[model samples]
Target: MKREEFEKIVEETIESLPEEIKQKLDNVVFIVQDYPDSDELKKTKASKYNLLGLYTGIPLSKRGTSYGMYPATPDRIFIFKANIERICRNEKELKTKIREVVLHEIGHYLGMSEEEVRKALGE
Candidate 1:
């Protein structure tokens, strides 16, 4: 798919989220990338195909009392366009996978464990 179409699908996925989750996402910035950078791959220990999205920041549950005292930046959730496309055979599957990735990353942002995230997504 074109970059524009990929970004649109991502935006649509975020917009489709529930109001409660949207409110909680106020401090996050979603980043779209063609593929995972070396740093991301190393941190995750995941190869290109396994890494779909990643949440990087101090999760909400682990924030200290001085969480925002300094010039702390907002958390980032990276969505990998290429990896997602590689696993999907069509736009329909891509869109569905995008939603899954979004939800999974948001669960991480909310300090959920992998098991918790999968359970929440009914996976």
Candidate 2:
């Protein structure tokens, strides 16, 4: 798929989220990249070929009272476009995979552990 189409799908996926989830996404930015960067791969310890998405920054649950006292960078959720496309054979599968990866990363943003996120997604 074209980069523009892929990004549109990502935006739609997030918009399709339940209102409860959408409301909690304050101070979060969604980014789409062709591949994971070296630093991101090292930080997550994930192979570039397999890492579909990643969430970075302090999770909401971990924030203390002083959390916003100073200017803070927004949390980021990265969607690795090329990696996602590589594992899918068609657009339908591509869309599904995008949703799954997005939700998984959002789970992390909401303070769920990897295991918790997996269990929640029935993976």
Candidate 3:
């Protein structure tokens, strides 16, 4: 899929989140890359094909009183377009996967573990 179209799907997926969840998101940036970098690919321990998205940065539940006092950076969620597209055959499937990946990352930001994220997203 084209980058613009993929990004639009991502935005739609984000907007589709429950309002309570959406409201809790702060200092987070969502971006898309063609594929996972070598370091990330190693960290995930999955062959590149199986890696879809990643949430990098401190989770909200881990923050303290002085969390934002200085040069701390916002969290980042990366969606791998090539990997995602490889598993999706059509636009509908693409959108669904995008939603799942995005929600999964948001779950992490909200302090959910991998299992919890999958459970919460019911995927």
Please provide, for model 1 over 1-123, each residue's C-alpha lDDT reduced to its tens digit, 9 standing for 90 to 100. 888888888899889888987887747888999888888887797887779999999898898888778878899999998889899998899999998998899999999999999999999
- Model 2 Cα lDDT, one tens digit per residue, 17-72: 99999998978999999899998887787898899999999998898899889999
Candidate 2 worst ten-residue window by lDDT: 39-48
Tell me the spans in candidate 3 whose CA falls farther than 4 Å from its real position. none
What TM-score would each prediction reach against the true structure? 0.92, 0.96, 0.92
Q: Tens-digit lDDT track for model 3 on 44-115?
A: 767777889998889999989998898788898999999999999988898889888988888898899999
Q: List candidate 2 stretches off by more than 4 Å.
A: none
Candidate 1 vs candidate 2: the TM-score winner is 2
RMSD of model 2, in Å?
0.9
- Model 3 error, position 50 (Å): 1.6
- Local lDDT at 79 for model 3: 93
RMSD of each: 1.3, 0.9, 1.3
Clashing pairs in 3: none
